[model samples]
Target: MVVLSKQTTEQYAYIRHCNKTSAFSSTGIIPVVDLSKPEAKTLIVKACEEFGFFKVINHGVPMEAISKLESEAINFFSLPNNQKEKAGPPNPFGYGNKKIGENGDVGWVEYLLLKNNQDYNSMRLSVFGQTTDKFRNVLNDYICAVRKMGCEILELMAEGLNIEEKNVFSKLLMDKESDSLFRLNHYPPCPEMALDNKNGENLVGFGEHTDPQIISLLRSNNTSGLQICLKDRSWVSVPPDYNSFFINVGDSLQVMTNGRFRSVRHRVLANGFDSRLSMIYFGGPPLSEKIAPLPCLMKENEESLYKEFTWFEYKKSAYASRLADNRLGHFEIFSAS
Candidate 1:
């Protein structure tokens, strides 16, 4: 069992735990889409509408790029605690541990958050030393491939919707000013959770929450910890496929579709022995972009279910709230009785 320091124990002690048996056993229920198929557009749309999440295969990203980045991330996380600390406390972009955000949400994870932009620089040269350039190159390669795949998926969604402008969704992400982000999370093995499972509770690696961006792409090692809440509110375990990427329709996408695509609420649990590593790319729009239901997607005289708000406003609101808070509730257009 991994022994936790007094501070570490206190940091995670107050976190909310869930029943380990709540996870659905059947993984076949999760949607799987092959991006190379001719029917991918329609399938992508269907998956988004139904699960707001799906596993994508043949997504055009090179396996070499994926493995290299994962290796680099592992090396960085393996560094001495002091060396890793030089990279951060994540002032919204660096390294973070246990604490999820400024809002007091804690988890059994440590992570590196980075802005996805042209000016992307290495996170503290001292952290990686001589391998900084290699790390940067690998990271850039991974981000480039993932961002392209994200744009492709969005265009496919527009095509499936039969929208006249196929680039309507993709263009936002392709924008140079897109407020995108990349994150690498490491959940170390916590055997203590198993010994303390008499109450049927498990440690939270990441709390349940919806992504706030337009879309998100996630790839993780072969670890069984991710769980997504279904429409009926039952949690289902997502079988890990390291070679494939999982796509999520984010809260922004949910609102832009006028609620057609519901954002999936998901969380992760700490494994008793195996560690879990995940990389996520959040594709966001430009800060100033006004988010609203596309006129083309709405029916005749259809009323918008949300008030128009800038991505900046929404993002600010999201960052200020707890992980499980309903970030969209403030932007909802309530009907007058």
Candidate 2:
């Protein structure tokens, strides 16, 4: 839980007012992909190219699983600070508060970051007490379902791009050593902070950044604070829909497509009256997996925009930098024309 001191509150506030504009007011402006549709492949590719993001429906994840995990998470977060601290400082994974990363970024949020594997079980068991088994079961069910949906989306992307191997992207995620991660973020309401602060700022729930993975699937409660930056550099709020999952094109995907797809920059603002809870599944490749522009994606004489690097290399660099840093810049190839 975030303690609301005047200094800390002021520090977390971000100045902006134009985000209230409805960017998705027009039909088809915000890509809505129905996974059950026959043309989903083409639509997914279009969404990746244009927005680096899209909303998915008919994704097959059980509503009971989603709600159950959310309920468990709320119960865990509602615990006393001292008790919750037992989950602790997140030395890469576990419970974390205010501090977003080791690189000095902070937000008005607390979160639990877990690896998508058995290793998270120990830490999870340590926190939930008597309900540990129930919490673990709910989390596992949710992760399993969402992982399947993520693979399906990746396969569709490959098919749409005419890649011979439909599973080229999905295979990495399915690998035994895949380094995927899941995060549950709780942005509590700050009713004490004046919405119309003298500086004209709103509290920052999470700072601006791009996910450093192959893809990211996000689902949040109806409380709206999530915003994505447009190509024109304008910020627009994404209306909440608890039943649907929002997909984000990640840095790895952008590289794999040779820049044909973009990694969207996005952030969250703290709501004044409603607490917001969100779950994000980051689909990553194995640590040793090589990352570079796919040869199949390049034109006959087109140059690779980025130098090759392993997932471990990129992840290290990304974690070392601030939230807003252009992490891909370090690996980008420059021609001395």
TM agreement with the true structure for every prediction: 0.94, 0.95
Separately for all candidates shown, the number of backbone clashes (residues 3 or more apart, or on different chains) is 0, 0
**Candidate 1 residue 17 C-alpha distance from true site, Å:** 9.4
| Model 1: residue 61 alpha-carbon error in angstroms | 0.7
lDDT of each: 0.86, 0.88
- The CA lDDT at 136 in model 2 is 87
- The whole-model C-alpha lDDT of candidate 1 against the native structure comes to 0.86
Give stretches of model 1 more than 4 Å off: 1-27, 123-126
